[model samples]
Target: MTLFRQIYSLLFSLFLLVVASLGYVQFTETQSFLTKQMESDLNNASTSLGLMLTPALEAGDTVAAETLVNVIFEGGYYNNIKLIWMVDGKQQEWNNPIKIDDVPQWFINLNLFKTIKKESTITSGWLQLAQLEITAHPGFGYHELWRIMSNTLIVFSLLFLVAIFTARLGLTWILKPLNALSEHAKKIAARQFGPDMPLPSTTELKDLVTAFNSMSAQLKHLFQSLDEEVGSLRKKNLTDPASGLPNRQYVVSRLNGWLSEPSSGALFLAKLDWLEEVHSKYGYQVRDETIRLLAEKLVQQLNEITPSVIARIAAFEFAFLVTDVEHDQISKYLQTLIRTINQEISKAGCKPNENFAIGVAERVGQMKVSDILAQADNALQKALKDNKTFHWFETTEQQIFTREQWRDNLSHAISNKKFKFRWQPIQFCNGDGVTQRELYCQLELGDKLTHAGQFMPYIELLSLGSLLDKCLIETVYEQKLLERNYEPLAINLTHQSLSDSQFHQWLNHFLRNAPQVERMCFEIPEAGVYSDLESCTRLCNIIRDNGAKFGIDHFGRQFGSMSYLQGLRPSYVKLDQSFAYYDEASHNSELCRAIINVAKGLDIQVIVTGIQEKAQLERFNELKTDAYQGFIAPPENIE
Candidate 1:
């Protein structure tokens, strides 16, 4: 039960008891007064009657005595009375008829009415009669007492109800602030610090709320201090204290957060290329001071042009996180910043004796932090290849780098047993079809197996995409190939893997050694592939050459042209649902039909995705598409 309801019931019960007690007291007092009054009346009547009959009794007149007895028995003012008299030691009495059931029997019994015969000498100026007798009854007192008790009970009932209503209002009003303060304290405990709520009018309760608010505010301040301290500690651990620039760990964390946001902004990747030469020419203090001066110089320039987060990711490698700038200007700004920094360094009498190289790569859509970092790293490497100090990441160069890194890392992770695999069952159509599974790989730490979605982007950002792909491929072949029935482990390949000849050779060698693994299929994201088709074709050919198949995931939505179909032949082509869904019925439906037809002519099986209803299934079946995949398929929820 609720608190208020319990209190209301308790208060109501107490009120009833109090009212009953008061009613009983009032009723008893009124009944006592009425009883005394009735007794006095009886005494007065007996006295008056005794005086009236004294003369008759003394004369010994029977007729007069008989007349007097008749007058006493049928008195007009005493219709509800009873009379009794004794003459010569013989008794006579009369009672008026009373058949009253208006009062209860128990009540009447409690106030029992009984006759008491009393004899006294009637005195007339010191003279005595033969005898005078009277009978007493409490009949009139009982009736009058009943009426008074009934009135008191009614009054008591009304007063009880009034008190109950007042108690309810008063209790709730008193507890209002206490309840609010309780809720606020709970919210503070949960760390939901915002504005305080309105308090009640009661002084004590209001004071409690005030104290609670003050405590919450102080706790909030303490937490803020702890946060700042933690941030400072982290900086001290991974930063060059003199320049206030990030060390290696700081660079890694920034890259991680940057990649966390989906390819929304641009970051500039620059390498110091020659910090040792500068330090060697200058003394320890001058070198330290020089690095600081360079850091300040970069900060000033970056701030002046556009406010950006500049960090020293490595001992000599620094990074600039720029706002979303036009793609072409990214390289131009990299050139400008390096020239400006070098120019500033020369102004301080430091000759251009040390060679510096720079690389620039911007965020790609849905790219992981590690992957973007890798892109910059790749850019830096390409700068070395061209014998130039700076180079932007071109698709062709990034591919070669991706493949080599994939092979190196895949070999490392697998030999060291760092690869782990997870599977998600793929539902086929309308929640009634047999389920198929897609297995993916992740790197395992002690007691932890992180999902690919968490750190795959980082692999590519650090230009380690190929290594991740190799890890996935090796784990699938070693474990899932013979251990599980989930065929065609849907491993994602980095663009870098596609261009590495050595990795492709290793794949072929492995497949040749295990011929049954020949049925393996690889999936490459369509958007990244179509970004540069020539590289896409080369990558596809290499995989097809190894007796393995390839499919374009998230395909047919974009980069769907005659050339894409003509160049690559896969075992199955999963259709992007843009062509197959219901909401596109009016305008985009025909475009979908066109895609299915194109795939059909090319002998590619089309698997339309995102089917939601039975009607869509019937239409796709009519369209003659093979292997429908959607939430409606079997899972009834997953697309």
Candidate 2:
């Protein structure tokens, strides 16, 4: 029971005891007074009757005496009256039986009042004639006692009820501050530090509220400090201070991440050959201003094309990583980008195309980072040698299917449910065992299974991501894949799925009937989360309501703020795989450490991905992550 209820019960019991005691005392006192009053009336009556009967007895008129005694007995105050002659000891007796019909039998059975008898001597001028005896009836005394107690009980009952109501109101008033404090504590536990609780009037409660507020404020300050520290670390290491674009390290890590998968993209390297001339002629300030202006113009032009990464690789060179664009449109986009940069620099009194050159290298399948970089560099050298504005280095390999072919193939596969799943175990840092298995989906085309990295781009391009998610989730549920063990299965969700209300409804219904629903964790990439945060937040809440978990995949892939983690608190975050390639002394390693510390401070588990070797595992283990997943224990085919 709550404190209020406990105190109220004790107070109620005390009130009942007091009321009962008062009632009993009132009943007893009334009974005693009534008993004494009855006895006095009986004694007076016997004396008066004896004196009256004395005259008759002395005159030898026994008949008159009998008549007087009969009259007195019929008065109903006395139960019995007797007159006896002193000479012959002859007795005359009149009796009346007690009959109390007004009072209940149960009250009379208590026998609260006793029968009172009185005796007196009859005399005529100081001479005794005969002795008189009278017995008073106890029925009247019992009736009066019962009436008084009944009234006292009704009065006390009303008072007791009023007292109970008043006590309840008082308790609620006094405990209101405690309820507020409890809610504040719950918010603090959730890592949501809002405001201080209002102090209560009671001194002790006021003190407690003050302490709780102080603790909450301190925690809020600590989390904010940690977030700021992480942000500062990211800015210091990964961002270019001059143009505010990403530094070379950040772009390289992202490119390496893409290269590790069966993904396709193009890398462009742009050089401003006039930067040295400007620095020597117009000074460093003008040269720096030119670079900053060029970066701003490039950002604006690229923003209209697609999501791409722009980085300052060198003082005069810039790199662009563009994905999800068709191979045929690469030349057209690069031409427009080169023209825009030339036009922007011309405004600074520099000639267009006189010193600007760009190189492009197309990515088809899984390729090494060095090969792509070298290819782009060769293209840049050719552009400068041939005095061309830009040059494209296209790879021999191309996409396997056209847009129409991909649509037909993906539609048929989704309809036929031609998908296979593999489970990758995420082991604990302590080498205890598998914590959970990350689910990887593959498309079944012909007799071969195609990896997600090969087909996911097309799925997203066709806006079939939501359908694909539903197909995979339904297949997993129907196949009872979750029943193999208590370990949870983590599935990655797309931005389309998170934003689709229909998908949300379907997932809610499906999970409601799903056995072991709690053993499921749906994850979204950091890019997907930031794309539509409101939708992601709603989806997270729905999944949590169904007793499942939510996670963020590809964490730190985007340079967006980490403040969203405070509100969209996922169960865990899988660091972007690029961090795995950097060594312990590298700036990326320090960046990784900062991200881990920020996440850990909020009680979020951090899992490092792409640990393909023992040395990599040992290096990341020093960072104190919760778990690791990669080729150290490659993904296993689920039977």
Candidate 3:
């Protein structure tokens, strides 16, 4: 039993005992008083009758004595009245038996009443002539005793109920803090930090609440420290201390992984030609400082166009990669990088040598690492010989529409809601079945269906990311995916959408009213997360409060520490396809292992995506991946 019930029962039982005891005591005392009062009345009646019968008995008048007896007996207050006299050595007697019928038989049998009897002598002058006896009936006494008992019982019953109600309120009030503490404990177990509970009035409960709050605070601090440690370890392993950019090893590993597939990306090599001049004129410190500042500028400028990886590959060489880039975009990006470097050098009061020369190469189809490197080197040698600003290795492509035409088509599609959603199940490697589905949204432009990458750049440029996110939510709701099965439908949200306050409010309200908000999961890309972590975390918390899940897609691509995990506590982390490329190099394997270890330590689920081979799946199985998605499950279209 609960403490409240146990205490209540004990209290009620005690109350009943006290009430019964008092009832019995009151009943007996009233019975004794009534008996004594009846005896006194009978005594008075006997004395009066004795005086009346004296003269008659002395005058030998039996008729008068008998008349007096009959008058007392007919009053119905006495159970018996008798007069006895001696005549010529014989005795004459008159007696009356009780026959009163007003009281119940059970009442009389209960002994609530006691019979009272008394006797008095009949005297004439100084002579004792006869005796008179009077006995009192107990009907009046029985009625009084029953009335007192019934009243006492009613009063005690009311008191019992009042006491019980008060006890219930008291117990609830006392245990209120304990309930809040229980909820707090649950939040802590889920790795969520909830506010502390108010202190209770009872001393013991107050102490307990205080202790729990202390423990929660300590635990939060501990977890935060662990996050920082892990982040430091990650940064130390992958980043170059001098430039604060990823190290050469990190870049090469990433490049190898990216090249493993038929992906379209550019590899740009920018060799700083002024490093030697700066070392000779301004010392090594100034050269190192200039390089660091230039690295920062490059990241700030290039990352704005796209999420690209900038790494220091050598003492005077830097390499960067941007995926899915067109030829003109690569040329524009390199030109801007050279201009920015020159500007920074001039601003620093250094003799601005042609700060750098860049060699850009784009991969069209399956190519070897040595082939791409040789092409980039050949382009660099050409730029140096020709004294040109830069050199590019180009490939052929067919363009059907100009920039303006493509923009108009994309704008029209968004305005007309010409988007199709195809949800593909992410099968669990553990065989628990599919609890999540990946949403691939496609935009239809006239007769063509274009994927996200083809149109996202335009959408982002138009500042319609929030609108697109809203449309996706509405479309999913309209599809009624949850009506069939209540597993989570994962939707990808862009950085702009997560940072938009209007979108946050709209999503919060929408989720509150949506029937299957609990089965919804919003995925933010790993690269997108680095720019707006605070807002993203807040958004994540909001989604979680509404019973939805959040996760980071394309994980293990960033070289920064996974410190964000401590705050976001995403339901799962989906490793990038490159992380599954165990055959690439030992560093890639090490990086994947590090991420998995950190994720596992925090109890986060690890899912591998882009599994196109059974061999890769088997390797992942051996490494204990939580789930897998891609050609293994095969994409299925939703009607």
Candidate 4:
């Protein structure tokens, strides 16, 4: 039992025992007093009657003696009265039998007071005349004793009830602080640091509450400090101090990540044609100010396009990447940016034509980082050579589908449930086999199987992500894929599904009926999580409520603060593949370690992805990740 219950039970038992003991003592004492009182009255009555009847006996008046005995018997106090006298050597006797009235049989059967008899010799002037005897009836004594004991019991019962109520209130008041402390500890466990608890009047509880509050505050401060430190490190290592844009290393990492996937985007490299002249004529401060102004203008121009990265790659050059835009639109946007840059620079005291020369390289299919950068650099040289403001180095485009064809293909595939599923094992770093298998799927279009990379962009463009996710979940359920293995099956969730309330309700119902729901883990991309955190958090709660798990994919890819993890608290995070390429001495490696540390502090599992070799695996071993996934344990087609 709980401490409160134990204490309350003990107090109640003690009160019951006290009440019982006092009641027994009171009943016994009342019985003894009545017994004594009855005996004394019997003796006194016998003595007085003997004196009063002596005259009658001496007068030889049997009638007078009988009258005296009858009067005593009729008084109803005595149970029995008798008169005996000798006249002319003959004996006469008078007797009365006992009688009892209102007392109950059960009380009389208790025999609290026993039968008593007393006798006294009758005499006239110191001579004995006759014998007078009287026996006391215990009826009056039993009645008096029962009355006193019943009143005592009633009073004690009332007191006992009052005591129980008083104890209950007192215990609740005393234990209220303990309950508050427990709730406060739970909040701390959830990484929520709220206001301190009010101290109780009980000294011990007050001290305990004070200690808990102090510990909570300290933990809150510790996490805040860690978040701040991580933010500072990101700013120092990945961001350019001069222009407040991402540094070259950050952009390269991002580009490398994109290149690994079947994704297409354009890379723009811009060179300030007058930066050298301005620095030579003016000072470092003026050059830096001009660069910052240009960066600000670029941000303002491209603010509408998300999933874009702008970086300061060199002393006089800047680069940026944009995806999901048509080539024609990209060209027009670049022309507008070039014109805007010249106009803004003229205001900063630079010649308009001598402003910025830009180069553009189109990334189609999987290409090396060196190839894209070299192509952009060659375009930059061509622009400088031709004295043009900007030049586009367009590469051969892949066979593309129109939006109508994509919508038709995706809708048919989703509705027909024609998706092929593949499973990839995420193994433990200690080589203890697989922790779980990540699910990857492809759409079957006729005889061809199209990977998610080729179709997902279209799905997002068509706003069919929620429908596709629901289709995939239904397929998994119908296939009973969870029963194929004991390990959990991790599935990826799209941002649209997270935001869709209808999808949430459907998933909730599906999981409620799923016997192996615990064998499932839903993963959301890092971008999706940060894009709409409220929706993601709500979805996470629903998944967890159904006993499934939630994870973050492409972790560490975002440059935003990691503080969100405190609230989201996913079961695990899959590090973005770029971290696998970073060497131990690289600043990205340090940032990776910081990420691992913060995740570990929250007890979240860290799994590094894209580990192609044992050396890459060993590189992450220093970072103390919980698991790894990639070519080391390549994905397998689930049969």
Candidate 5:
């Protein structure tokens, strides 16, 4: 029970005990007082009757004494009366009977008042003649006792109710601060620094609130400071000082990583033809200003076209790595870059001959980083020799599948639900057992099955992301039998899948009565969430309400703001492979620590993926990662 309820219960019990005890005491005292008063009245009536009868007997008026006795007996003050007369040494007695009326037997039995009788001697001239006896009825006493009890019960009941209502009001007023403190605690868990609560009249709770506010302020300041420091360090190391674009190392690393993956890629190199002439005519400072201005314009135009990495490789040469795009798209992006640079220089009143020369090389398969760089350089030399502003290197081999053919295959696969999944175990960092299975989807092409990397790009291009997600959900549901022996399943969703309203509606309906739904988890890429945050949050809320957990995969890659997590509150976040596998430099360490700390404050779990090295796992364990998913552990099959 809550503390408030406990307090109310205790107060109510104490009130009941006090009221009951007071009622009992008052009832007993009232009964005793009434009994004594009745006894006194009976004694006085008996004494007075005895005196009056003595006078009549002394005067030899027996008729008068008998008349007086009969009159007193018929008055009903006494239950019975007796008169004894002495004549010639023989005694004669008269006795009257009594009857009880109008009172219940139970009430009479409970009151149990005793009958009071008084005996008086009758004399003639100081000699006893007969004895006059009177007995009092107990009916009156029973009525008085019952009345006192009823009044006491009524009064005490009303008092008890009033006391409880007053106590409730007081307790609610006093505990208001405690309720605010509880809500404050929830906000802190969500990584929100809320306003301070009002101080309570209760001293102890006031002190607690003071301390809690102090701690919250400190944590908020710490997280902000870390964010600023990490951002500054990342920009300093990866960006060129003059042009504010990525450095040579950053671009090359990204190019190498993307080339190794199963995606089409292109490398574009552009050279400023009049850099030496500008430096000779003007000065080095003027040349530097021109290069910076040209680089800014080129980056602005490239970003408007598509997402690409821009870098300054040399004093006059710039490079870009555009992955997962067709050769035509790369050529268009290059043409836009050249046109934007020339327009910007013309606006600066520069000569028409002082322009940019660009070269492009496209890859469909795995190629060495050195080979890509050399091919792009050779193309640039050809462009300069041919007196052309742009040149392209074409491949000699024909592709295995045309664009239309791949689209047809993916569309058919999604429609027919011809997709298969392989389950891989994700283990806890503390050496505990596996927590869940990460699913990898595959498609069959004729006699052989094609992996996701080769076909997912096509599916994305066809706008079939939602359809693929639906297929995966159905596959997981079919694994109900396997779920009995293994952990739950975690599936990744594409941006299109999360943005589709119909998919969300279907998912909600599918899981309405589905057994073991809590054992399912849906994961979305951090970069994908930026596409439509409103839709993403709505989808996440739907999944969460249905007893499934939401997670962010490839986290910290976009280097975006984390304010979205406050609303999403995902169950866990998986670090990107690049962040987890790279060496722990000072900047990287600071960045990792900041991410973990922010997640911890939000009460969200952190998982580091791609920790293939034992040393890397140890380092992450020291960083308090909740789980790891990589080749360190062999993939365990679900069935």
Candidate 6:
């Protein structure tokens, strides 16, 4: 019905015509060749049998004649050598029935249906004794032809098997380069570039390898030239964008890895009671600046305690990991110092008589990063909730032992490489309705797994954050991407990692190793984006340059006033636990609506996370959000 049909039909007709012409030539030439071969062999064998029979007949030995026939058949070299006695014009006896073994069934069956008919005269003592004809029996004619067919097949089979085996070996060599080319094409289509596969042994494949390497180098150049967010590290995380306190995450990670050590200490953790009022009256930033002044005062106070660590741990909370304190005089002396620090901060700060609550905690007997801090944290929480001036969680022997055990297990998990990653799905409103899960690193302890939120501080303290991040990205590629074939996975990033030039180089190098960074969605925590805005921006640029897309994790409660994100846009943003669980029933808060609208205006899709119920899904659907992640869709099936 079309040009394609007409062309195809003509080609098919031509192919059939060729096949028929060849088959006819083969058939005509084949029969004569088979007939001559069979006739000559049969005639020679009969003559040989006769010469042997004569000796037996001259001896008048009937048994010898039968024995001679038995030997001829037993030899089996000739396809046929049969003896027959004509009795009253009917075959009375025969010997050496012909059959060719190790031949194909089709040849046997074909020959079994065709034959030749001819006769010869037999002589005894130079006188004709009987007229003998070698005509095949009507039913057995095919068997004669079968013998000829078997011989013909035997010749060709050896050639065919050799050719097939050779072709298979050759194809394996050729396919190597083709396979690598296909992989390169796939990577390009996915908006990622990876290393070329090993070249084949052929010249053609070597050329392909050269071309692919050139392409990959070009891509790498294009990337490094475009990244500008990594402005300068001299003032890294010096100012916390949210509360303008040196950002606890940055300070703590540094302290845990490179600063905190075994020493006599009297660290103080304090909570501010006036932050909410200031924030409520003025704004989050106004409260943040008040917090900033408090942070500066604490830092200045710590200089008096010199070589001590002080950082703002939360919205209105700060901690000082202090050392060089006498153990026995700690109770009375630290309390006096706390009073002095509060006195200075309160006198300079705004809001009349804005009292600051304080807590004191200490470490004893081989102090651990988390255990020591936990004591201060517990004391801080209690004092702040009650707005107390100072309180402490004095360590007991049992607390010390329990803390020791956790340290052992945590160390073992890292040493033995016994952690696993789970994906929290980040949905996109790509309108394609295709949603995929993003893998986040977490430990898979026997019978009990823990996320970063549960134990990352300890890891940060150990200075293993970079190692941990590398392990996660590598494992996801090997286990989930290549081995398990997951479509994509989301990975988290840290400020320390973004600044570590050596580690960043290692990651880009690793990505070039194949199927590693192709589907990776590196997530910068939404809070981090707000807290350490510069670091987050730099991280996005680095990740993009490495051929990865960035997703904002816990993507809300921020981005309200940031203009930087407008220029350095991420591919997706996951709603924070609070925003994801926002109240949705017959109405929407203006703030909630504003968040969606703003993200939408930036062309950034929103993912509603923590959706554990059907009501949440319906609500997300009502809001017309891009995608939803939670128990409503189990992560495993999507992966």
Q: Pick the candidate with the highest TM-score.
A: 2
Across 427-447, the per-residue lDDT of candidate 5 in tens digits comes to 888888888878887888899
CA lDDT of each candidate? Answer: 0.60, 0.84, 0.75, 0.82, 0.76, 0.57
* Per-model RMSD to reference: 23.2, 3.9, 6.3, 4.7, 4.7, 16.1
lDDT of 1 by residue, 1-639 (tens): 767788888888877787777777777687667656756766777777777777776676656766775777564323333222334554444555443446776787774544544556655566554455555555566676777777777777677777877887897787776667777887676555557666667766677777887887786565454444434444555466767875555455445544532223456566664556667767567766777888888877665654456777666677877643334345556766877767755765655523566677766546766777788888877876676767766643221124345456545665676866555444444445433445556665446554454445445544566656666676666664534554454556776676666666766666666655555767776655666677667767767776777777655544224345555666567665544443344423444555566566556766665555667677776667766655453322111
Query: If scored against the real structure, what TM-score would every candidate get?
Result: 0.42, 0.85, 0.74, 0.82, 0.81, 0.42
Q: Is candidate 3 or candidate 6 better by lDDT?
A: 3
Checking candidate 2 for backbone clashes, the offending pairs are none
lDDT of 6: 0.57
Q: Which ten contiguous residues of candidate 1 have the minimum total lDDT?
A: 76-85
Ranking by TM-score: 2, 4, 5, 3, 6, 1
lDDT of 2 by residue, 1-639 (tens): 978889999999899889888887887789889988998898778777877787789898889989888878787778888878886788988888878877888878877777688887777776677878888988778778878887888888889889999999988888888988888998888788887888888888888999999999999888888778777877899888888899998888988788875566699998887777788889988888877887888888876776788999898899999875666556667877878887876777778888878999988666788989999999999999999988888567767788788899999999889888899999998988988998988887777777887687788778898899989998888788899867899998876898999999999898888878889999988987877889888888889898999889888888767878878889999989898887877777777888888788778989988888888888876678989998889989989
Writing each residue's lDDT as its tens digit, candidate 3 over 1-639 gives 866678778988888898889888888788889888888878878887887777777788778778877777777668776666745543544445544355566766866565577877767777768766677877667767777777888998898889888888887777777767777888777666666778877788788889888888887776666556546655776688888898876666566656653345688887877776787888989888988898889999987776788988888888888775555676677877777878776866655547567788777557666777777777777777777768887557555356677678766766676788777788788889996898888877768776665666556656778888888888778878666565688998966898898899998999889886888999988877787888898798889999999889878777566767868989998987766656534645655666676676667888888787788887776667798887778757787
User: In candidate 4, which residue ranges exceed 4 Å CA deviation?
Assistant: 37-154, 189-191, 196-214, 262-264, 277-281, 323-346, 349-358, 378-397, 501-516
Instruction: Indicate the residue-level lDDT of 62 in model 3.
Output: 72
| Model 2 RMSD vs true structure | 3.9
Which stretches of candidate 3 lie above 4 Å from their native place? 1-184, 192-226, 252-267, 280-285, 301-307, 322-335, 347-355, 361-382, 392-395, 398-408, 484-486, 526-530, 559-566, 582-585, 588-591, 619-624
Pairing residues by index, what is the TM-score of model 3?
A: 0.74
Residues 1-639 of candidate 4 have per-residue lDDT tens digits of 888899999999999999999888887787788888888888888888887787778888877777877777777777666555644444544444444556677778776666788867766676777766678877788678767877888899899999999999999988888878888998888777888888888888888988998999898888777777778878999999999999999888888777776555689999986877778879899889888987888887775543578899899888878765555546666876777777777776778977579999987666899999999999998999998888889677764677788889889988999899999999999888899999999877777777877787777668898999989888998998999999999998876898898999989998998888999999999988778989888888999999999899999887788888887889999989888788877787778788778788778999998788999899877677999998777789989
In candidate 4, which residue pairs get closer than 3 Å at backbone N, Cα or C atoms, i.e. clash? none
